[model samples]
Target: MIFKRKSSATTWQEVLEGCLRRDTKAQRQLYERYANFAKNTCLRYAQNEVEAEEMASDGFLKVFDKIEKYDSTQPFEGWLKRIMINTAIDHYRRNSHKISWSDLDEASQVPYSDSYYKDEHLVNITADEIMMFVQRLPASYRAVFSLSVVEGYNHNEIAEMLGISESASRSNLSKAKAKLQSWISAYVIQQDEITHKHE
Candidate 1:
């Protein structure tokens, strides 16, 4: 029912319309365009690049399979991102039984000077490194962190999505932040020492 757009520079709206009509080329084009975005979303939740690839593929399949349900008025990229995030959450739910949650209240309470996060050494850190740190978090804490900080979901929203209490969601986010802060601080200190030694 859907025909491929004639121009190579077809707009996303045209692609969506074509995809709605089940155009194969349109589907392929859409996947190609957004695959990296999906992979990045998956990377936030997956432990490694291999798992992130799997999650991205599965999420794309869902996106195509459920394309008919997509509302045209909404931002298409945002819709796809939600699907990718949900796919990651589903993956987490399946494997989370193997992971345990811990209370890190002391870490959470550690006060840092205002300049701590602004260290020059941190500028050298890549986005991938930051994502790796997030990926290294325990399943529950990672989920809460991704939802709260990356996806901008509040505690109530995260709790509803994860079937946990709001308090638990809040707790997990706090602990995740605390852990990341400590890890980054250590990394910065190491980097500073290395720089000084080289100097």
Candidate 2:
């Protein structure tokens, strides 16, 4: 009976510990559990699902390759998130970011809704569509927008994370917001037109 319980314990926490040892099977399991989340993270930084998925795969590979460097003392998910963030940065650096930033404030916080209705715009727009739009943004805007809006990082953290000045971080976020608002405005107009036509 004790042996059976011990066996189950080994099967559980042992798996995560295996990741620290760079065991492929354990890493594969971790990847499976977190791949979707990481992919979504990547999507915010990529131009499309295909590219996001590819970046996700690369991030996972990096995690596996650098597992030994991961500190067992820290939360595994946080460590993994850092890897995903780096992967996104790598993608950004490979592309472009022509915009510059200066002193700017974050847009006012929107209250969170405890419940969501299926009829909401979220149903109308796929997460991929939004991600593609974000990816199309210039590199400078992309990181700040994704970090502030999606990942919930503040300007200071964003600046620290990307090694930019605080004002630069704010500026990027501001420009990103203005651009996204324009895109949303256009999308809303298009939807209204379609609805009117259908009616």
Candidate 3:
């Protein structure tokens, strides 16, 4: 004889409980519900789709492995997001040494040029273009930028998470912004030249 769930409504709480019990269906459901969100978090820290997907998969495995330890009172999605971000950071730490580090003092002192790329120019750029520019950043800069700008984490929090000094976090973020500004300025100029040539 097969037993039926008393109610057809399978809330997220039920899904979490089921996942804790190692139910395959519940696990699949949970992954399906949050996969995009997890992948996007991975993408922000990843250089490409393959890396992002790998991080996302690893994050899900961690989520399943540690789901039982999750606090029921907290937001499940937020908890899951933190796991994904940590997974991405782990990937960064593993490969970070391969990349040369920038001078921390130079990065810290990289001045922002207000007239370089206006706010309106940035507003006009497509999200995909912005993401592409971010992906082009050096790995160290990318990690700090994603942590500081995308994830909205403060420098202290980012430093703790990435095992770097707070000053390093600030420096990396500053350099990333400078690089992105340069790219955006160049792109705007190129587009304008093309528009004028065609006119």
> Could you estimate the TM-score for every candidate?
0.82, 0.70, 0.85
Instruction: Report the candidate with higher lDDT, 1 versus 3.
Output: 3
Please give the TM-score that candidate 1 achieves against the real structure: 0.82
Q: Model 2: residues >4 Å from true position, as ranges?
A: 1-12, 66-75, 90-126
Give all candidates' CA lDDT scores: 0.82, 0.73, 0.87
The weakest ten consecutive residues by lDDT in model 1 span 105-114
The per-prediction CA RMSD against the true structure, in angstroms, equals 4.7, 6.2, 3.8
- Against the true structure, candidate 2 has what lDDT? 0.73
Residues 11-35, model 2: lDDT tens digits:
5466777887888888877887888
Q: In candidate 3, where is summed lDDT lowest over 10 consecutive residues?
A: 111-120
- Predicted model with the maximum lDDT: 3
Ranking by lDDT: 3, 1, 2
Q: Local error of candidate 1 at 16, Å?
A: 1.9
Compute the lDDT of residue 45 as modeled in candidate 1: 82
Candidate 3 structure quality by residue, lDDT tens digits, 32-78:
99989898888888889898999999999999999988999988889
The top-ranked prediction according to TM-score is 3
